[model samples]
Target: MELAKMTPLAGLVALLALAGPGAAETFTLRIGSGHAVGPVTYVNTSRDFLVPEIEKRVAERTEHKVRLIEAYGGSLAKLDETLEAVEKGILDMGHVCFCFEPSKAMVQNLNYFIPFSPPSAVQQLAITRKVYDQNPALSEHFSTNYNQTLLALSGYDNYNVGTKFEWEKFADLSGHKLGGAGPNLVWLEGSGTTVVQTGIPDYYTNIQTGVIEGNMLFPSSYFGLKLYEVAPNYKIIDMGAMMVNGLLINNDTLAKLPPEVTDIIREVAREYEQVTAEALDRDQAAGIEKLKAAGAVITVLSPEERQAWAERLAGLPGAKAKEFTEAGFDGPAIFRSYLDAAKEAGYSFPVAYAIE
Candidate 1:
């Protein structure tokens, strides 16, 4: 039988039941993630915080028969390989950061390059979930290509202008040396700003040595990476929210699980998704405060400045959609569906670009 032809939900239940409840029998699953356990005084909170939570839930719900062995902090796999790793069962499940593979994961990063009206974490999460739920084709694309299931979708905090140079408009970026991830390179175009491809880990020193003038990143991540001390200016671009991470599981692994065990996993994922969202919301506000206390200047783009930047990239939306469709997916339609659903859910982008 074709794997795609078989629906996922029921298959999962039978597999778990077959594993049986014999006291002597133990089933082990290895899940991979990309953050390490750190000291109590760490700059960024690790996935270490989530490990115990998952273990507790699994033990309580599965009679302690299933063990989720974890590979943390890219020890088992790195971000770019995670999607394929999970699908090929190189690891049962893993953390997939789309930003690392934006070219291949266009649909996943559609919003990463766009600007948000409020640029609030809570609003971004709400809109993301609604957009994900409303677009099955977008959801299924993952299943079809990676042979994995997207357990949950979440967004990171908004990107702030972290730089040695202060910026309030797109033009201010001109002649500036900047480092950025994902599609942020587009922002440097026509502005004379030179784009440096520095990974997040190198952002701090790169700025300090004059290797780059500034970089764009989420405040939480900037704090996590300690870029504030070197650059010391946190400018709110309001361009868009950043999506740093998500989790995916091998479909074959998921299909092999007993329905009850699968149910437990799904429930735990949903719970953690909410926990993550709330934490991100709080962390975003907290990060800004922490950076401000540390002497970082925060710049909020005025309405006129925001519009000017938006105008410079006037047809960016169409170009993005077309790029996706040209890649053999319904990129334009997928993009439209997300926006329409967001509007339906009461999210109105101040400047609505008519997507083809």
Candidate 2:
């Protein structure tokens, strides 16, 4: 096999062989999201970190190359339907928001039920990942039910309340109206406030039109969306960061690829969790300052009132766990594990929210 005598295809094969164990292939993958990049940190990370890092890592370490086609703002699918889109290969992969897929992705909704988690995005992600790793069912729910593989899980920054007016205690807020995403609306339970179901993208218009007077949201999303213009009262309820979004790939598409490429994709996806969380944390910290500069009034719910609120909401975790059990999951165990992880990480919740 003299160098000058080698045929072109054979030479290329030799080069690939020298580079790695598997033959090289160029893969075209389509990644998408329901929301635009600026308002959603997960969507931003999909484009900013996941896409580029996978391409870079594969090229540097393996013979495979990846070509990612990105779509956002409901181009491929809405946030709730991205799971179905990925499952059916309408989009090769997409970011799935669990808040919208409540029934289908039950286990992934654990964070919302177990509220008042530590407000740190980095710590929240760590807790979620730990629970996911320890409980295989969390990840398996995707592959078993959706025909999609979970690549990585992501979290929103510290969730808070933004309103047109301020109230000191949950009782004083009774009879007002507030809006939030599907699962989180229950977080305001028993408050005289009427909880309305609203998504982040619609919060601005909904408030402006008087459809709702306030909403629950993370600071970064609140700032990115400019909802501060309408709802200038920032209430730091610190409902905790929630692992609500997931990066997923169609199983059929993954099966067509060689291990070299799939391995790189999975590795990069794991790193995506840390990168997205850290960036969201920074954005949240900065968002608060920006909101204030723009004339948003900020308030912190007193520790006593926060504890009272948590106590009022204490039944939620246990109730949801029982509901999960009826749906054929170990609800008690799952809830307990998440609580243990948070406690182990040294988060002293406002109250001892039990599984009942």
Candidate 3:
């Protein structure tokens, strides 16, 4: 006989087996991130700000039934391996650097690396969110290739030079050993300087040992990593914002979560998304103050010089965008939309560099 036509006992046993795990146990999800337990750092912001916020939101929405175990400061896994770790279930949730996984999400990081584009953190984050929300293929690609889901993005500031020497313009930067990460290399290309590529965590030592004359970084990173003591010239270039980082979760873990819990997590991400932008502004101001107190030279690039530098780097972005588009994502269009959004947001690009 068919199972439906069999016994009542068989039906009850089947139902019990199907519902057993969900009804019998409480789930403790382990959320992992690379930053330390407290404030934001070069490693990540979501670990410091977004994780707690998400936990609070989830608890409030789900009646405190769900528990999340936070693994911070690479206690669970290395910073560069976050995406892979999440995919392998070594981490249930993580703050992944899309730059580190460029093969998986080059379009997103290309916005950061493309020179002379994305003028502000708010605009950058806005466009990134819009693009991800609109592109099903991109989202599916992340899910299928990495087994992870992008929960939120942490925007970056316009990188500037913090150096031992005064640099009033890009021309003044010639022949300096500027330590920086990926995109800054492109920015410094024609400046006649040697670009020393080093991790943010290693910047302090690199400077202290005279391995680099200066480094390009956002103010928060300069302050967070104590770069002020070594190279104290803070010069704002306003070239563009870096993509900085992203928060992601294991696709399987996210899929298995109660829908309400997942919704709460995303809700908190939407709220914390602005934290990086606002914090960047504040940190930039604070970094200027700290540099002044430390007797460092601060030079704001003049309007004419900033204009020249902008024009010089402008072509690089389009070229890089083509490279990304060829790899299959519409990088040029994404970059254009980002710039257009920045214009719509009332940012007068080439704001005359002046001391406030």
Judging by TM-score against the true structure, name the best candidate. Answer: 2
Could you tell me the lDDT of residue 269 within candidate 3?
71
Tens digits of per-residue lDDT for model 3, 1-356: 65547489998998889887545334577777655542244234555566667666666656445566878777887657777788899988777766555466666675655555454676767766666666555566668678887766775566777897876777778888888666457777788988987756578899999899888776666776677788877777666666557677788888787777778877777667787666655665676676677666677778788778766765665676677778887765655655555567655554322111
Pairs in clash, predicted candidate 2? 174-192, 175-192
Which has the better TM-score: candidate 2, or candidate 3?
Answer: 2
Number of the top-ranking candidate, with lDDT as the measure: 2
Per residue, candidate 2 scores C-alpha lDDT tens digits across 249-269 of 999999998887889899999
Worst 10 residues of 1 by lDDT: 37-46
* Model 2: ten consecutive residues of lowest lDDT: 16-25
TM-score, structure 1 vs. true? 0.84
- Off-target runs (Cα >4 Å) in candidate 2 are 1-23
Model 3 lDDT, residue 305, Cα:
85
User: What are the lDDT figures for the candidates, one per model?
Assistant: 0.69, 0.87, 0.68
Q: Per-prediction RMSD in angstroms?
A: 8.6, 3.7, 5.7
Clash counts per candidate, in order, are 7, 2, 0
